[model samples]
Target: MESIYWVLTWACHRRCRHCYEDRFRPYLRADLEAVVAEAERNAPLVLGNLPKRMTYRDPGGPDLPEKMGRVIISGGEALLEAVRERVTYPVIEGLVARYRDTGGVKVVLQTTGDLLTPAIVREVAQRGVWMISVAGIDDFHVGMEGEAKRPPSRRRSRQ
Candidate 1:
């Protein structure tokens, strides 16, 4: 397979009008070790098949295909307060440690951006996350209240 989409948890804070995860199987808790083991098992296979190196369209940029296919870690708000430390970070750390030396294995994080604090962002980036894709600013998602009235500024996490 070119990539793996690992849904780390089924727990989300929002009851979005358009989200279907709650309507489906609603087992919100994730099995951290199981998910990590599975990713560890499959990562080598995926990484092995990719080219060792490839030229990028932008010569000044990093290499392609060899550094491109994503192992996207997402969920019912993957970074939800409940499971961020318990499931999400462990999963990311495990996979990054497993594939740090392997080419073409970028660890990508997908979150709703609701609970992403500066500390969490830094922790993930330091742990080897190549990218963080936030899916928060949509009309369907009910906005937060009071202290969390606004999603954390993405710029705050910039290195």
Candidate 2:
């Protein structure tokens, strides 16, 4: 159950008022090889308690040993338009493919519900990733220090 989280990029579409207004930049390129190497070194240590002969599926539909570890790909809104336009989607997909090919780790994705399109969900399913959507209600002011911010319409459920 060891997990590695990689922040592949820094670009986001929606700006949270709390985010630093002056510090916004996208990751031009991610060092995939470095990230993989780090995962390879740390995954086994994290999964020390897991069974020794575990098996898992790779992105290419092959089953491989789960001796290495689990990995998670995340970013500043992984599904944000800026990230998608930059390197978020490709890096995540490539990581999943490599993890599956190696057959030694699990892959998960963290995202905002705003970008969970049907096609994206299908692709995630095919890659055997566990998608976690983070959302919550807060009474704190969005822009002002104490003023409450109104919830966005996109968060409303259609039931």
Candidate 3:
């Protein structure tokens, strides 16, 4: 079973000083059909893509394998409040359901864990998603975003 990490968007609510350039942008909706098509064709262990906000390119051009090993969903902050307010959760849920139906791919949710709440976690778990929190230790602020603006404590957690 191979794995592929997909970057869904760059838009986020919190303005972390250490945030990456890609984080400050609008969300771009990829062509899910194309992405799935490609995945079915390529049994990649690890796959990642830029967020919808980062590019206008159509991702609905390839055919993916039906039995992918794993699928990772990521974004500027996978659990960003704004994203959740918008449509991140629904999209994630839909994808998870589709993948699970195949009984071949395991969905992994990559998040910062900042905006994530107990309810959200429970919902994700119910959908059979494996949550993976990404965070940085020591100078976490510096690593998150290059520019140092506010106090380290005020800055968003690296995760």
Candidate 4:
């Protein structure tokens, strides 16, 4: 496989007309923590076994094989304030640290710009996110108001 398209959560801050996902869930902190732990344990092995095609060359150095390829993280909005700093950030950091030596894992974050702030952008960039794909800006996904579509408070216990 070329890259892992990881959906961190189905919860979103928008109810876009064009969205493919019809149902959303309010993912709790523990749920996210558990996911992070699981990913941390298994992701490297899965990625390592994938076909390595990317090659990295350094000045006055030999070409090195890229062990892991890329990790594309997406969600209703991965940058949503509810889970950004706690869950999402840790995943990005962990991936970067794990594959920093072997040509580095290209971490791509996908989101809608509704919840992104300058500080958050800066932090993710620093944490080795190679790209941020902003989506849902067209007429189908207009009306950025999030209250109507917002899932129940993520802090609430799952019923």
Candidate 5:
């Protein structure tokens, strides 16, 4: 099934050695109301905030009468500094909670998994939001963050 992806924020706690989205952050991010307003603005022109408009049988056909499948909430790291910078943990929880409360929208979270605390895990579980951890893929995208500086003591001896 198709999914609707949303980048909730650009703030992350880890300055990873391969982060491509490192430069696109604001010093301060939007609050929950702003995020909700933004979500409302781009929402499909249907009741219950459903994605019934994105389904299509043909490339340039009319709207289908089916649901759009799933809603994926992602970011630089949603549960980490993104929540810290923009809204509080509860606010994001509320956002996911909305999708959870919606009968048709299956909510999925794509995150780095470095900051999934037990409390956060419990919250996600309680809200029935599925999570996809992406912490183990840093090596393949090595150049995004460029060469990292190393201390002389820990540096490898050059031949």
Candidate 6:
């Protein structure tokens, strides 16, 4: 099976030292229509070889198509506050709704949970999108040149 990864935004709240986007930058707004079209085109090729039709419940509590595609909405932390102008809750919600409405396209939102709010989570969660969440071991981020920088945290260490 093949996968389609789309970097919808490059803006982020945290200036992580390890982030390549922080240095190079990403400016293009993802053309969701084009992405969906591509997925539709590839669906025919993939449908014929599905291991088996997997049945799953949709947002509205209906069965999704046996042959479906997965669309991952990723970025420099999707819910980052710094890039609010480029991406917002409405923008994300609309994109997700459109994709889910198309049927059989599993939507996944990848985030670091920096700016994630309960309302945003509820909205997206009810739409049937899968979440790919991650957290760092510490507040430090390794720089592009291998230097590490740590952020000041209000939370106290256990030790």
TM-score of each: 0.62, 0.49, 0.51, 0.63, 0.50, 0.48
For residues 46-86, could you state the per-residue lDDT of candidate 5 as single tens digits? 22354433333435545744543556666656665435323
RMSD score of candidate 2 (Å): 10.2
Instruction: Please list the C-alpha lDDT of all candidates, in the order they appear.
Output: 0.63, 0.50, 0.52, 0.66, 0.51, 0.49
Order of the predicted models by TM-score, top scorer first: 4, 1, 3, 5, 2, 6
Using lDDT as the measure, which candidate wins? 4
RMSD of each: 7.9, 10.2, 12.2, 9.6, 7.7, 9.6
What is the alpha-carbon RMSD of candidate 4 to the true structure?
Answer: 9.6
Residue 146 C-alpha lDDT in model 5: 22
Angstrom error of the Cα, residue 32, model 6: value is: 21
Q: Residue-wise lDDT of candidate 3 within 42-128, one digit each (tens)?
A: 322222221112112234654642334666777655565445534455555655544544453566787655556789888778766
Best by TM-score: 4
User: Which ranges of candidate 6 are over 4 A from the true structure?
Assistant: 23-67, 81-103, 135-159
Candidate 5: regions farther than 4 A off: 16-18, 22-68, 81-103, 140-159
- Candidate 4, which segments miss by more than 4 Å at Cα? 25-68, 144-159
Off by over 4 Å in 2: 17-68, 101-103, 135-159
Candidate 2 lDDT, 1-159, residue by residue in tens:
355666544544445565544222333335433433444454334445333422444556445533456666665556654445335445545555555544555666766455678887776667566555453124331232222233454344546
Tens-digit lDDT track for model 4 on 1-159?
356787766667667666777643345688645544554455445545543443344345455433446778887567766667656887788777666655667889998777777988899999889999877554566574344234356334536
What digit string (tens of lDDT, one per residue) describes model 6 on residues 1-159? 224565545444456666655432323346433433343344344434432322244455445434455656666555554343234344444444544444445667776655567876886677566664554334453231222222345434548
lDDT against true structure, model 2: 0.50
